[model samples]
Target: ARPDVILPESSLLNLDGVQDAKLHPSLGGFQSLYDEGELAIVQNVGYPEQNFSHFRSTDIWMTGADTNELLATGWLGRYLNNQYPNYPAAYPNEDVPDPLAIELGYNLSVAFQGPVSGMGMVVGDPEWFYRLVNNIDAPVPDTQAGDKLRYVRLVTKQSQVYGEVIKNAASKITQQGGYPDTELGEQLKIVARLIAGGLQTRLYMVSLHGFDTHDSQVLNSDHTKGEHANLLATLGDAVRAFRSDLKGLQIEDRVVGATVSEFGRRIISNASLGTDHGAAAPMFIFGKHVEGGILGKNPVIPETPDVEDNLGWEYDFRSVYASLLSGWFCTDSSTLQETINKPHEILPIINPSVCGTTSSYENLYAAESWVRNYPNPVTDVTTIEFKGTGKPIRIDVINAQGQIVETIIRAKVGAGTHQITWDASRLTSGMYYLNYHNGAIHQSNALMKH
Candidate 1:
């Protein structure tokens, strides 16, 4: 089934911006991804008590913090560090062959910040990345702005860590053909090639801009032939080309792409046929393993909206972040919660083939993975063992729905064998996920509470 794209009502004919626009069907590229069951539309997703300021909203999204609180580290960066502790330090090792995450394009994002330091590598293209890596000067400027960017500039130069590997990968893979000549297409093409060459990077960050359509959103006569239309078409074209390239490269299953913005435009158009900053917009999630569906029904268009009127949030954007961490990356509930610093529901977005227990992703874990729980269905108590990296170890009992049922331990534990006895007699009899966090690494197993 194709996506349902509600076209903007004809700009000239629109008496009030609140009138429901005629359906134009969903974008072609997205429609294809949807029909193939490789896309999920999370509608009306954003933070609560919205702020219209682009910088503030962007900061909120990047840090995954509450609109009121300020957090410096990025959620994705924390997750990657969880998988490979002491990143950029333990990195470039034979066990870990590539940078854990790569940020494409020039958009300096806060989404990849890790504690102590940001853990991802920044690159433009294969050639440009090499040039920057080779010619890096380490002395950071002495200023507030310099201190803020000091970490990013430092990590950007760490290309030496994965430079050879990336170069080798780019040399081996050849893109199939027909990518739009747009900036987004160029970035995605590089990403696809690197993944095909086996970079083993856990996360790839890229973005598309030009969505801040205030004026000339749509043509006066044709609802779909203006600035906004052109942006959508460019995005659709880029996505289609990238999808085809991934298919040709045979690495489509290993990667997933998502779109994010600080805030969406208002529900109503102004006299200039443009929308003001609004709240609760739609986000697109695409991957070979995604379960495609319209997250919910079309957003109920409130009749008679105002400048302040906007779509009510259905799912918090952090919920989608949680989904990517746990469902796609198989991050345990405890680490995932810790990374976001907020409890958010992990959606059933990915197909069971990749998200279920006994999935192939389990093979990616370290050999010294935590021991399994004993007394399969614990009537009174269950015992488990784990090896810590001399860091804080957090053991949590997570219910089937991915909620933390109990906190068995939360203090720092030493290396070697540490046994834990979980008292689950009081809990209801059902399956649960036992999440263990040893330093930056996380491991989980299924436990039955009987």
Candidate 2:
């Protein structure tokens, strides 16, 4: 699920004991670098039951009725398309560009793609982006046909210049201070720079790869270090550094970061001393807006051996997404339903009983609401209940920002007290919310599990 702040490949680090391990590569010396006040060790956000087979093909993940319908345009894409309907397309070539003479970039990713004239900017080297903007007037070099070799040289030079421009844009990105040298760190640095530069970007997207750790994952004499551990260390350092950088700039309140992957590694270590393909993985969110604690009920890591070689899921991944759409973005529940395309309200819009009350209603706290899992997180069964006037009601689970996760109820009932249990043995772990509504009243509450 998408949130203001996300760490797609976050690690569960021991922030307190890392100071003395500064020289250790495997540990990454996190405690030595960050203050306890700044670090939070969150567990159970990953998909314990991840299925690797499903990740090999985008179609498998994107075409499934349950998965595809939940994520039609991606969280960022939908937000941008809806926020700025007039923003230029990601791609609008001259020959292929519409008669309207619109200029566009290449493929559109909902995170960086927006309809607002200047609501977002692709994070690149500062000098390069500026060069592209200024070089719009630069003329293409011309050479006589008899001197074909000269023309080839010119083209090569131009290409090099273009490459340089891109690099410079990425390098020249300037913020007040604090940026890690890692790839994802650099990208985030650029994001902070853009925000400081008044780019007005409301949604940002960045990624870190190398999480497919399938071999040699232990720190033994025979095995140097696990691929998974190293990757996790980098992730921890980069994210911590990014958070520091954002705080230094005083823009932490205005921005959030979240991370996702196609899927997660298998729970059971493989014969090769590494994990294999699995279903459901963890996702992380970071920011002042985040509820800085673990969410979701932890899935049971089965001790009983099985051929599947993976842990089970406690909550559906879609529930996390649904929370983002409805909660953080402040989008209408109905509109979100159309985008997600699942039946039943995935998120609760208004507290059904509180809707008519005069008592001051507080905005849901991002951290507090998400910090605790209710009925405990479940792997096989989850109970959904509603209390109020006897009426037909529907219940839905949404993620932090209000994207629907799953519809728990849809039928009418002579409602005095009603409860439904979800067979979520096949879902992932993350924060989710339950929305309950009758034709006349609406309500929402947070749900969490590992």
Tell me each candidate's TM-score.
0.69, 0.57
Which number leads on lDDT?
Answer: 1
lDDT of 2 by residue, 274-383 (tens): 66555545555555555443344444444343334333343344445554555456556565554444422222222223223321122232222211223665656766
lDDT of 1 by residue, 1-450 (tens): 001222544422221122432223326666667667777877767665677888998989998988779888888777777877886675678787787788886644788888867777778654575454355444667998878687786665563566777777777765465788888788888888788887778778877778887777777776657777788777877888898888888877788888889988766677776787887788888888887766633554433434545565646688788777777777776787788786554556767667565322222334345757788767887787766667777777755333566888888877777887767788876556566755434445566666
* Most accurate candidate by TM-score: 1
Candidate 1 positional error at 403, Å: 26
The TM-score of predicted model 1 comes to 0.69
Worst 10 residues of 1 by lDDT: 14-23
Residue 46, candidate 1: how far off, in angstroms?
A: 1.0
Q: Provide the global lDDT of candidate 2 against the true structure.
A: 0.46
